[model samples]
Target: MEQDPITLIISLAGGILSFLLLMRFALQLSQADYYNPISQSVVRLTQPIVGPLQRVLRPKGRFDFATLIVALAVKAIAILVLIKMSPMFASAGGSISPLHLLIFSLAGTLNTLLTIYFWATLGAVIISWIAPDSYHPAPQLLLQLSEPLFALARKVIPPIGGLDLSPILIFLLIQIVQGYLSALVVI
Candidate 1:
């Protein structure tokens, strides 16, 4: 039941990279200001791989499929490596079905993606209350990233008594979807 240092390192590195890639994908999807320092850092970190991938996999509309693909691949590789190193997996003969691995990776990717939005939505709500008109790149980026989800929730929830409940609704929906995705993983 003891954790390995190498496994921890791999997990941390993979998770950070995957999050950055997903951010790049979301920033493009949201049409976020590229000049933002955070956006610039994400693009700079991922450009090495995404730049080349873009040549073969051009973006569809506002969706950056290249960044998404890299994120998913990174998640999959991280999961695979961790599973191989897991004591439980070793005890079980270290054999995972390809289908199971695929499902796990996809579920992990989606879970992480939703997690990004979950925090973003929460951050936007807090920022709106704290500094509704702030021009800072971080706040602006959060608002841009979360507006789509809030819009969707607004359609269903709407404002009541001058209190917007979109963030609460979006939070509930994200949690529900994330739970369902987690259920899809067999291992």
Candidate 2:
């Protein structure tokens, strides 16, 4: 798991940017409070890139494809850079084919999105117990972002004894999907 400094920097920077852009996209889709400070920060941080793309992409309904596209591109480029720098890849004497890059890009993007949901759902569950009625933006945003997934889980496994078990199901589902993606991508 040794990484060169340059690779580490690229991965860290790209991951953060991708995560933020994904957050913006998710928040928009979830229709989270636009005025929430966290939402505003995500929007502001991503606007420079998403604003221009929005002009061409034109959002449809709650889906903001531009932000998602940018997030994918960022993750793709970072993976490409890291792959190019890897001695294992270099030693194989193989150039990165476009199709392989596309697969890796998609797998990486989906993985990041799932990771975001995983944490958001976990946070929302904790917040529900600690301060269910708190007006804090973080809890509110987490709850907003996670509600859809929670709803799905609730459908299959309703609350027992007035205790919701949806978060557990959602966590299991996320892990299963991530595992499948890892097996499919092989990178």
Candidate 3:
């Protein structure tokens, strides 16, 4: 948790961008309705960047491969910028390795995105319990985003008594995966 100005600026700005990009990436994957306010806003916020990247890195089905690249690129750039400004680099006579930073960025990006999905899935479960029929875009998006994960969990353990336990079960798995990815960053 470096609090230096450079680190702070990069982290704050980069984190917001990364989160937005991640949101856009998930929405793209879920085939969210663009007309929906939340989905439309995400698209508007990310279109300028991902739109151009899409030209070069065409999508596959409902997947926005371009959004993935842009999100990863944003994360890598943030990591590189932070590394360039770190006191460690100065102490090490500016010999920091780009490869190491790149690895960190990739791991961090994956971890963050997974964490987002974890929360989104939990939100979906909560929403399902509280208001399963809500027509809001954000809630609907969460359900859509969690569908694939829930399906996996359903495969392992089917719902009982009109209750879906996949969310709780899957949430634990997400935590395990997040920890694993974070450990990879250290390596």
Candidate 4:
């Protein structure tokens, strides 16, 4: 399996950027504290791409459509660039159609969202074991991100023995969704 080093580098860089961009999109969607160090850094890192996209795309209420679009674009462009850099990649799989590419990018974005939630849930669970304080930005953000899911779980499972089992249920649910998304068809 011969892999082009350049393509690997480019794809990894694009993936990281898209992940960060999607994080900003999620944070905004969840109404996270914008003044926090993480939120501010995400905004600054992605401002260059998202700033112009916002002018053209316009946002829909709290959701940043431009940021979402930018995240998808990053994935799409990375795949296209990889194909271009290594024509062998195309020959191995046949030509990738535009519609196929779009679906592929969207699936990737969905997978990324699932991944973000998985980490957020994990962090929130860990913090609850230590100190779940609102004064700290990271734990607050994790709690903010995971609370809705936890709420849903509580509605279904409820607490037991004065212990919050919402996190466990949330993890199970996240894993189920992750499995489904991973199996999602792009064709």
The CA lDDT of each predicted structure is 0.87, 0.88, 0.80, 0.82
Show where candidate 3 strays beyond 4 Å. Answer: 184-187
What candidate 4 gets wrong by more than 4 Å, as runs, is 86-94, 183-187
Note the residue pairs that clash in candidate 4.
Answer: none
lDDT of 4 by residue, 1-187 (tens): 8667886789789889989999999898888888988889999999998999899988787799999999998988887777666676756664578987888788878888878988998998899879966578889888887777778889998999989888787778767876776764221
The CA lDDT at 174 in model 4 is 68
> What 10-residue stretch in candidate 2 is worst by lDDT?
178-187
Candidate 1 ranges beyond 4 A from true positions: 91-93, 183-187
Q: How many residue pairs in model 2 have overlapping backbones?
A: 0
Which pairs of residues have clashing backbones in candidate 1? none
Backbone clash pairs for candidate 3 read none
Query: Tens digits of per-residue lDDT for model 3 on 62-163?
Result: 888888788788887877777667677778764547777677778877877887788889899889889999998889888888898888889988999988
lDDT of 2 at 172: 96
lDDT tens readout by residue for model 2, 1-187:
6768987899899889999998988898888999999999999989998888999998898899999999888877887888888888998763688888888888988888899999999999999999999898889999999999888899999999999999999999899999989854422
Candidate order by TM-score, highest to lowest? 2, 1, 3, 4
TM-score on alpha carbons, each prediction: 0.92, 0.93, 0.90, 0.86
**Any runs in candidate 2 off by more than 4 Å, and if so which?**
91-94, 184-187
lDDT of 2 at 95: 61
